[model samples]
Target: MRWSIEVFFKEAKSLLGLGKSQARDFASQIASISITVLQYNVLGTVKRFKSYETIGGLFHEATDGAVQLSVTDRIWGILQELVMIIAEAFQIDDERVMDTLINRSETFKHFINLDKLELKQAA
Candidate 1:
């Protein structure tokens, strides 16, 4: 248990930016820590579902621009495009569709980050 805790802290410091905050205010420090923990949790979920055995390995893959998108990445991109295409074809509002998807469920919102998705209509 202690070893696991140490490993987690090590990864948090090195990869997750846990102790890298320069904020001087208490609230800002707390916010920074919270954000770091949230980032760590998201990465942990990715590591669990993906083939990565270490957070470092996952981070490397995510940051390496030379690496080609995996099938899952390609599928996600296609899904985004499909959503836009469907909205255009059906004369539906793209932002409304995204808002619906994002507000529909917490799990969907968490996985897709739909709020951050910028839907650009094809001109």
Candidate 2:
């Protein structure tokens, strides 16, 4: 049982793309790790529902059945998930992410000014 658990970790990190990290910043790394953990949880949950021995088979069973989802719907869902994930990573509870960006670069400051102008116009 313990040996198989070690193999599972090795396979999960290598075969399942868990050990890969391309983030250039600390917050981004934290968020990427968080998202990876979320993905692992989802995969494990899907695996639990199937009797299949392979992870690919579990994915096939999850998506190949009734109620086929459209590509647009999936894209939208992915975008929404990324937004929520990024927001959580940014820890922007009261202030906008744009506010934080104002200190990051001149480009972000310009964008924040433009955004404020737009908000002023809307109000």
Candidate 3:
């Protein structure tokens, strides 16, 4: 399903307590990661459903009740692996990119919100 950028920013800003500029920055980072993930998903470097569902489920499960550092850290680790694979495929600096992307809490918030929305809409 196609996600609307405006909706992403709106939900992310609210959930992550991010300002518009920060939300935009986070959104950009997510877009880049998503593109890389999609590439990997298509190329069979990553299992489309397995990777996407795991990452997506992590966010939902993490946010369903309380938001904790441990949960967030675990989710971060999963994303880090995904990012590393993408970076390796394209010969880029995985650590630097992953570090930057993981800190964007707004991006994660949007991811969860969008995934929830997609699922609900599908149902």
The most accurate candidate by TM-score is 1
By TM-score: ranked, best first:
1, 2, 3
Q: Alpha carbon lDDT of residue 23, candidate 2?
A: 71
Score each candidate by Cα lDDT. 0.81, 0.67, 0.60
Assess the local accuracy of residue 9 in candidate 3 as a C-alpha lDDT between 0 and 100: 49
Give the Cα-based TM-score of candidate 3 against the true structure: 0.25
Residue-wise C-alpha lDDT for candidate 3, range 1-123, written one tens digit per residue: 246456444444553333423335767767755654453334332325455544334435546766555776888688778998999998999987766675677886687789899999999
In candidate 3, residue 63 scores what lDDT?
60
Candidate 2 per-residue C-alpha lDDT over 44-68 given as tens digits, one digit per residue, 9 for 90 to 100: 7767775635765554565566486
Model 2 clash tally, residue pairs:
0
Candidate 2 lDDT at 93 equals 47
- Stretches off by above 4 angstroms in model 3 are 1-69, 99-123
Error of 2 at 45 (Å): 1.3
Clash pairs for candidate 2? none
TM-score of candidate 2 against the unseen true structure: 0.40
Model 1 agreement with the true structure over 59-83: per-residue lDDT tens digits: 6776686578889789879978887
